[model samples]
Target: MEYLILAIIGLASGIVGALVGLGGGVILVPATLFIGINLGMIDGITPQTVVGLSVVMMIFIGLASTLSYMKSKTIDYRSSLIFFAGSIPGTLLGAYVNKGLDLPSFNLYFGILLIILSTLLLVRKYLKPVEWFVKHGKKRSFTDATGETFVFGYPVWFALVLTFGVGFASGLFGIGGGSIIVPAMILLFLFPPHVAVGTSMFMVLLSAVVNSITHISLGNVPWLYTIPVIPAAYMGAKIGAALNQKMKSETLVFALRIILLLLGVRSIIDGIWG
Candidate 1:
């Protein structure tokens, strides 16, 4: 039964993560904590354990989504490498920071993070792209499947700084960092939405590898739970990537925002009460 629940969590997280380029850790981490600690359905759970598991699961989710995006030719390889340069070290620092957080503190912080992410998603469509970053930075062009050409770029220095912060949050919170990265790419860098999502997954894959290794070394991962989660998430990622190409996601985004908001509130309440 526990394995089944884990699998469902992985599947749902993978689909949402790949579709939105958030790497699914937001879903995985919160769900795991709710089931194991809040609800008392599973044993030996902790903030550290759930975080480690989420990062480990992201390895598979990132790989699957990145591969799917590769076929679509939406991934910006050059940008991905640049983002990695900063994110790698940021993740290392974040993993160390995670060790210091107890459950109540983790819940409070994580809840705040979720609310922030939810607000970002809510405001994203209404925000205009910042032209300063695009005009001042190096430029690149992409022609999509529909033969529409789009150009986008960002200052290298600024990108490094942004991704470093994103990585730190990922390592500290066990999120994929896409919640912040995707919006930055689209609004600040003028990236096409598809390209941003694809490239973000590539970055997620790279950062997850580093973060998961760091968590494993700290003995935070619960291997048993991962057994059921990994494969499910991988398959779900494929489906999500396909869905991204085929449909409008406005309604889905709205639903996701509501879910995040509720989760954030509950987490905050639990943190305060406990």
Candidate 2:
């Protein structure tokens, strides 16, 4: 029964992660904690174990989504490499930092992070790209299937610093870092939305690999539980990538915002009162 629930969670997370380029850890980690620990449905669940499992799932999820995006030609390889340069070390740092967190503290901080991410989703459309980043940084362009062209870029140094922070968040929280990266790409670097999503997934894939290795070394992963999650997430990612190309996601995103907000509040309450 626990395995079944985990599979379902993996499917949902994969779809959402692929749709938004989040690498699915945002949904995967929270759901696992709520169900396995908060609800007492599974044994031996801890924040560290949950993070480890989520990062492991991300390895497959990121691969699936990144491969899908590759066929679309939306990824920026050069920028992704630059982003990776900084993210690797940042991920290592975050993994070390995560070892010190207790359940209540982890819940509190994770809740805060979720709220911030939810708020970003809520207001992202209304925010314009930062002209300074676009104007002063390097320039690059992409031509989409519709023959529409987008010009965008940032300084290599800035990208490195930005992705470093993103990697830290990913390793600390066991997320893909797309919640922050996607927004920065669109709002700071003026990347085309599709390109941002694709590139962010690529970065997520790279960071997750390093994050997983770090967690494994720490002995945090619960290998048995991952059996059901990996395949389900991989399949769901394919579905999500297809959906991303076929339909509008405004309504789904709005729903996701509300879900994130509620989950964040719940986590905060649990942290304080449980």
Candidate 3:
């Protein structure tokens, strides 16, 4: 019965995650923690353990989203590779750091960061955007699987630094790196929203895989908790991917921004009172 409940939770999370390029952390982390506490089966589940299980569910969810994004020819592999160069190492380091963190402190800090990021995203949309740095990078173009080419000029060096920071937070929180990556890609690197979403999913896949290994080394994950949710997460990812293509980019970003704000507040409140 516990496993059945986990599956249902995972299913809902997977769909929302894939849709917003969040890899399900916003829905999964809080839901799992609160519900697990309510149920005796997960009576003593630590934040690290909750994060580890979230990683398991996200891996499959990211994979499903990746495949769907690939079919639609929106993934920007070149950018992904550059970001991964930094993200991989960062995730490894973050996982180790996360093992020692207290839940309340982590929640407080992470929530603050999320809220800040969400504010920045919101501010950039309606206000005059300030140029962070001057980049004279050369424009580049790449063709995707469906013979569609995307051309853009981006600050590669800046992206690397940012990706590492995002990866660290992702590993620490088991968010699969998409929460930061998607917004960064769109708001920072100037990628089209759809491309950002697609490429972010791929980055999430890599970050989650690396992060999961670190969690495993610390014994944060239990196979039984992970197994039941895998299939449900996968199914949800497929549906999310389909929805992503149909939704307008502006609409998608707007929804994600709102979700992030809510997640941030929830974490802060939980940290303070729960």
- CA lDDT of each prediction against the hidden true structure: 0.87, 0.84, 0.80
Q: After superposition, how far is residue 238 of candidate 3 from its true place, in Å?
A: 0.4
Instruction: Indicate whether candidate 1 or candidate 3 has the larger lDDT.
Output: 1
Clashing pairs in model 2? none
Q: Give every collision pair in model 3.
A: none
Please provide TM-scores, in order, for all candidate models, with all chains considered together: 0.93, 0.93, 0.91
Q: What lDDT, from 0 to 1, does candidate 1 have?
A: 0.87
Cα-based RMSD of the predictions, in order? 1.9, 1.9, 2.8
lDDT tens digits by residue: candidate 1, 36-56 = 888888788899999999999
Residue 124, model 3: lDDT of: 66
After superposition, candidate 2 runs with Cα above 4 Å error: 249-262
**Cα RMSD for predicted model 2:** 1.9
Q: Which wins on TM-score, candidate 1 or candidate 3?
A: 1
| lDDT, candidate 3, 1-274, per-residue tens | 7788789888988898999888887678777776775345555577898888988788899899999999998888887788878898788888888888887876777778779878878886775432442244546665643466655556677777888898888888888888888877666556667888888888888778888888888899878878778899999999999999889778988888898898899788777876
- Give the backbone clash total of model 3: 0
lDDT for position 11 in model 3: 92
Q: Pick the winner on TM-score between candidates 2 and 3.
A: 2
Question: Which candidate number maximizes lDDT?
Answer: 1
- Indicate the worst ten consecutive residues by lDDT in candidate 2: 247-256
